[model samples]
Target: MKQAFDHLKAKGKPDCTTLTDHLDHVVAATVKAATAFGMNVDVARQGAILHDIGKAHPVFQHRLKDSYKHSPTDEPMRHELASLLFLPVFDKSLWPVMVEMVVAHHKSTRNDTKRKGIIDLDERFGPRAFALHSAEWGSWSPTALAILSAYGIQARPISLTEAREAYDYAFDYCKNTPDGYSEWKGLLMAGDHFASALVHRTYNQTRRLFNVPLLTYYNRQHPLYPLSYIAADSERPHTLVTACTGAGKTDYLLRRCRGRVFYTLPFQASINSMYERLKHDMGKDNPDLDIRVLHAASRLTVEKNKYEEKTIQGHMGSAVKVLTPHQLASVVFGTRGYEATLMDLRGCDVILDEIHTYTNVTRSIVLKIVEMLKLIGCRIHIGTATMSSVLTNRIRALLGPDTVHEVALTDEQLDQFDRHGVHKISSYDDAQERIAQAVADGQKVLVVANRVETAQQRFQALQIAHPNVPMLLLHSRFKRGERGRLEQQLTGKRLDATGRPIYEFNTGQGACIVVSTQVVEVSLDISFDLMITDTAPLDALIQRFGRVNRKRTPETIGKVKPVFVIAPPETEGEAKPYELAVLEASFNALPDGDVLRERNVQALIDQVFPDVDNILIDKDAIYVNGRWRIEKLVHKPKSVLFDALDIDSMVCVTEADQQAYEQAGYEERMAYEIPVRYHAIAHNGLARSEGGNKPFIVPDKAYDPVLGLQMSLALPAFYNSFF
Candidate 1:
């Protein structure tokens, strides 16, 4: 007998995986995945085994040895298509579902782009074609027999007639049950992907579920006012909470969870902070809980640890997952990997925190996600401090009335959390003296600017005027590492030698100033004595105000501090992100008194964001009502639907150290990263590097640690382009 290789990978180096081992692992994974959803185990196993049978073809083996080279004369050899050759051997009754899993493993049935002359059976399996494919039959014979024996199937001779019959069954199945057919196709893909990514063994369904009582878990660490007490009042899965800051919203969200939880935030920074907090809080009691943080660079953060070398691929079985809403937005956009996401999220409890913080496009997409999740039977829980009645009514409209558990703090409860007093500024330059005096009086002052350039300018002016005071400048423009360290210092805590937190709240000794952008709105836990900010939407202003007097008591509610609001931007274009009408309306609606009440803040949001229909621009309308209509919701665009959020933005590196950028790991390289808009790059004369796939970047000297990207340095002549 001739010696056979016995194993092969579809791609990669020669020896990483064998054909049989791949089949074995995938079969087990598919069975576990399908059985989780109450599917037929035998059918799932048959699909998994049959999916890769054509990989054993002699032509495939020769191509694998040559790393899969193809010539124009040779017919394209797709294992997914080739597997159809053996479909006749299966029970004819099972061909409809089983053939789908085999042939559509690597491609979409609804969006199959390679179906012209390729899927035609007569052209592929004609009399002369059998002679032409003798080598393929020769190599496939032994593996096919082994697979049949491993799967306990009766051996039978495969023929072209049976193959044609199988194709007819699949074609009829697609015509009759399109939606149900897609479900099986998606489930099969999910199982195949999960199993193929497993490094050690198959899926483990024996793991323990999260059965610990949330109230008991919170009791271990005495939270000042446990919101769990309110949440524990009912056992409903869907909830809507509207509570102010420092009211234990996180605990309330968790208390309502009955199964695995998916907690989503608005920003990447906020997601990172929440991940660490949950890791420490929940990890203490359930050390074995699989809590994964999904984000763009999450793998980079964990890969630096030597012990976690094989944990890069995400596992859907994680008990708790902290991520940004962009991850869930994939389902709304119909991205390629959305099938696995659909499997993971179905029947899961999803917490949407800070829903008001997203842009109009993201907000529209999130609502669509809510619509689909409701259809798929996912329990949706939304938590926001500033939701208007109009938006609330729309949410009710989509989710159906009386279906959600709506909960909010009473007027009396909201009054106790009242903190900031508002003072509108008429004179811009004269306000500098007030900030200087506040810093000199041993008070912690915060300055929030509408733009990064404005923040940098304010920070420079403050530094030159009060050089002795300790000051920190923060924004999205800073490197990831520096931003993390700055957040640590601002929060005033770090881990000790034994991994316990060390308190470092300001003690009213030396005065300090923190100049930052809108990044401080969501989840950073710090209280400032005074705040100076520019005019923004009412919802945003409420979130910004939550940072001041955050830990107030009933006695300190009305006596906390004051927030100074600067004049609105000169023109509508100046407020690039926020709607100009919303900003103007918010400025008009502020109470005249210096004492700003928390209850009044809610009224202001209702006035400003009462209806998004009146304020949505043309571009926003396209996303919300036009493209994402109910009928067109599942239409897959040529590109990602969520690509608008990150379009024209690139992960740029300086031109001087392109080599160093390439050599450094993801974490290390992100330390020097700067986010430059495409418009800025176009006007600034920056060029994309020719080295690899790195983004277009300016010279090193263009970026400053304190001032961020200095457009003038790169485009001194065309500096007005940005302004």
Candidate 2:
């Protein structure tokens, strides 16, 4: 028994590190994080040290093998219940708090997914729950106490009756607590996540936890960028900025923030681009800044520190996080870990960079998000490009003007961003003259379509037209590995020996073309010379126009370029995604063969969306009347967001990659995924992978290295891609 730490393990698989070593990490990580977030550090430390001490039991130790999950479920030992038996180790007054921290670190004490919580076991076994846990406590109690004594958390031996009493106390606390999330549980979960993912590197990572980066990099302001010159130092608690594209909106948003920043974008394509941009721009000021990106493809995001950096992508303590609003919407729906998420965002600065909010469902959700953030004490900063008064006023009314610092560009300042000459056309065929002329004149061209099949079709046509030009096709359906490479080629920076940015799109290089979908509308960091796009909603059209002539330095301001807008689709099937009336209004509001006056964008948007106030789905949202509708510790049974948001819900791999997908490691798995909506490929008779992620195997001919996913080839050919 004195050789307590000898062969006892805390985990299974490749890294079966000892229990004491694991506890040492949990203590170090939890203490640092709790201290940073103003939690009870002493309780957190003691709780973490003893959280997994029950693993010292022979039942748990035997199940530490790779295939233990498949073992017989007769006894169904829960380590947390065994852990509570040592409550005699701590001061009597600290028992409840200590129990709160460790009892539910892995599962909620009640209503857990698998019914494996401490109280769940007690409920099932009646008087025999303690017997199941303490059956062999006598043989292992000394070993567990000695291991804790090493951490200076000494506990005297406990007879079976006292151990049963300790179990009863935890059971009572778990069964009788009122509805609310426990900060102790959040602390343990966060610390456990970092310690588990980072392992030995936990100490180094914890040393830099919850840092606030100095955004002095945004101080570089040109006279042309009006938002930049405006004073960000204000007594107001919130900020709202409405300006034209390239008018320093991002910089202003950052400047207005007072604490850690969470930057949200409207599209996934834009997330990585923004993440890279900030990690570069702000990296100097914050040499050790822990920037994070929250998204589905986060597993595939490039990292300077590889696995170690990727481990903490969405967990708390990041100086700045770049993500889409959907990632945070889970909080509103009371999804799993909502309490931890709430705790992390409390009193921090959140930048709502962009929101689609085109439909009533999304509009209500975004509005609720702003309201919830404010209620949680977050200093909210919102930046948008020329929104309609309906939406704009709704935002103002949500965060009362008394606490909001509102800023907008004057007409003269807005005029300085007048960079595109709008030309209306009938269809793709009509825009060929400009496309040919742009490439002939050594200029870059960006062709936008509303759908994947349209984009792929256009890319094919353009490939035939300009056989020798440097061209690329981008959209939502490309495999992640391919998308990363394509994005780097499109907007990646390569500084010259003199330290100036000199790359293809950013440096005015020409004779190239990129055919894409709405993914190019925002945060692409790209500046093309010409744009031939299928007309979209008025607000969306403004964003698409910004992609062309995006370079907005002092010297380049007011330099107009060419952009041809194709006529909106006439039929409902043709306009499958957007409403026809809205599309027509957007097209009618635009100026033909004249500069798109930046000052009139707000009016144009209002003309398209005459009544943004009609949208509402507040009943489905969890944040209502300035309070969280759900209780703290427990999550709602399910969320309604997956249906409301137009997001990809599944992934597929080419038939050729199916073998590699089976053999690939977790980090390499997402690289092979070509994200697709489940219904898009479900009809095809495709094979699903064996493991948990279950990636569908599409016919090899359905995917092209150059043109993304071709529903034309994938669907009628392979019909079984279901959710």
Candidate 3:
């Protein structure tokens, strides 16, 4: 009896779950999600209710138990196509929409990989696939219909011929996709994802979806922060705040939003910091606000919760989200789940924090993103420290010049944010006297390098030079857990309810030295009394200068400190990422031994990036102009986007943690990953683990608990100190 009762199971992998239970959970989710998104709720609900009835067929049932051990034919029946067989039982008016919602939840309806789509199946099977799906239709149709009737859906028994006829109708309708995306597909995908992840708890989370957060916390104005005094409300639909750092750009951007927000930053580390800050500030008043951070390792930043893990992966209903713009780039490429992401971002407020953090390719993609956001009715707010005229004109043109509310600090006000004097140094070693003097004076110091190897070397030499002073090294190479701990140590502060810091980072105790890479350009919240940095792009260097003398208050608004810029390296090889011309231009453009005036920054930026809009984006991009450059329902492979992303493609873990990595849970496993470029480890001959993220197992000597991954020490090197 017990074995027979399990005949209507919908899912078999991991464990068997009943069809009716899954249907009910998804129905509740779709109804709530559809209502919140202003979509057709009945269409969503009916589609959800009937989408999985095909699982009741005996072939799927047999495969559900045996994992498709020996199939009746070569290709297993597509559940998405089989679900259409029961469409005749639902409201006829909703059938077309229902077909859109169900035909491609897991795969594209046309141009699916390996010819697995509904239309592909029709062509492959030549109308015999429906008969294959109806081996036990008489026995299973009653059970499936009874489950539907329980949801108040009246239906008679669906015959094999009737099911085949339904398949024919759905196949003909799905033969061609629209010129644009299908938001109905997005709704179904999101709903199905939530229900599948949360099960019976889906409704509880659904009630928390799309709750617009209260941003009154940002309204606290101070005279020192001039952007706070400027009125954020305007008749314009979009906004842009061009101001120096410490000018209250974040608060002004938040106040401009009229709906749920998608806060996009250029880096994941900065995204994590903003997520924590906004969560702390807003959680006190609006307890139900769904604030989430998004990135590859974002889950490790927050508390371990199943719903949070699935809900924050570029999903809908996050009240306030902090993420990298790369997360939204798929919309332009029409990658998998692009429609769902577009649906979530539709009619929302998007804040692009820093304009120049991306390289030439990503900058071009961001230009396309601005275009997509404009088309889909999203209110955009851009915050930048330094931006060129060409890029500004491009953005202004895309956003409509007359409709955008552009606010920048006046010349007098920009003078207030001038807190760092640019000092040219021959090399980092030349800053020894200044660093020693600052350490003696109990002042914090920062050192920046362009490459991770240089940063590690600088840290070692500095640690030996300043043997007694507290020192730390921070870069993008650290593991997620270690990085979080380091960020806390860098700026950990105890604050009163009024938000004034009582104490922070060993305040009033002593000085510390932080050696880092260009990552420090936009990630940290702490300020140093002095800075020593290698020359980078002028805009990037300006962002690095923001870390020094950054503690601004009514009294400390105009207080100036010193920042040393090392001369650019000799050759293009030395400047691995940035162009040598740009680096030299950035170095030469700085006003040595003088205050870096904020009013002259735009001219400086334009000097460095005279033709930032001249970069080519068409070769790698899938969306050009207002229309997609790819097939209607087809998408570019992830490799293409990953290449365009310009991020490290592969991850590796130490040999010591391979077993632990393979056995770890989803949340715990993320901590072990160390993102690396594929070519970097391709010749290492390391055993790759078949686990989460599929990381290659490097030798234990390559990684250290304190120093991070050392590629030179990856192999057995007798001279390497890490060994």
**Candidate 1 collision pairs:** 8-19
lDDT of 3 by residue, 1-723 (tens): 224444578787664678777887788877877887898787788888878877877767777775457735566577767788888798778778888788888776666766777766667877576676666678877877877777778888887778888888877777655567777887888778778877766767778888899989999998878999999989999898899998899999999999999998887667777888998899888876888888888877776455544444556778888898888988877777787788888899999888677888888889988999998899999999898888888899988899799999999999888898999988878999999999999988899899988989888888888898888788777777677766656666444679676453435367888888876678457688999999989999999998888888778877799999999989999988889998998889999999999999999999888987465666756656666665344454566677776765688878777788899987678788887778877787667888998887777877876678888876634223342
| TM-score, structure 2 vs. true | 0.93
Better of 2 and 3 by TM-score: 3
lDDT of each: 0.66, 0.80, 0.80
All candidates' TM-scores?
Answer: 0.84, 0.93, 0.93
The candidate that wins on TM-score is 3
Tens digit of lDDT per residue, candidate 1, span 1-723? Answer: 112435555444533567767777677767766776567889888888888877767676677774556776675556665666666777778776776576556654443344312233334454443344334464466566556666677757665465555545554454344222245555677766665665334534214222322324653323345354574546455788888887778877777777678888876657767877887788667766666677764553342453232242355556788888777776665655565677777788899998887777677677777876786778888888888887878888878776788788878877677677788886457478788788778888889988888888889988898898888887877655556666666676455679676544333356788888888888776788888888888888878888787775656646758888877776778977787877889888886446777777677788787676532222322234324321111224425553544446555665555667667755566665666566656665555655434655666666776666665565434233322
- How well does candidate 1 match the true structure in TM-score terms? 0.84
By TM-score, rank the candidates, best first.
Answer: 3, 2, 1
* 1 versus 3: better lDDT goes to: 3
What is the number of backbone collisions in each predicted candidate, taken in the order shown?
Answer: 1, 13, 0
Instruction: Provide the global lDDT of candidate 2 against the true structure.
Output: 0.80
By the lDDT metric, which is better: model 1 or model 2?
2
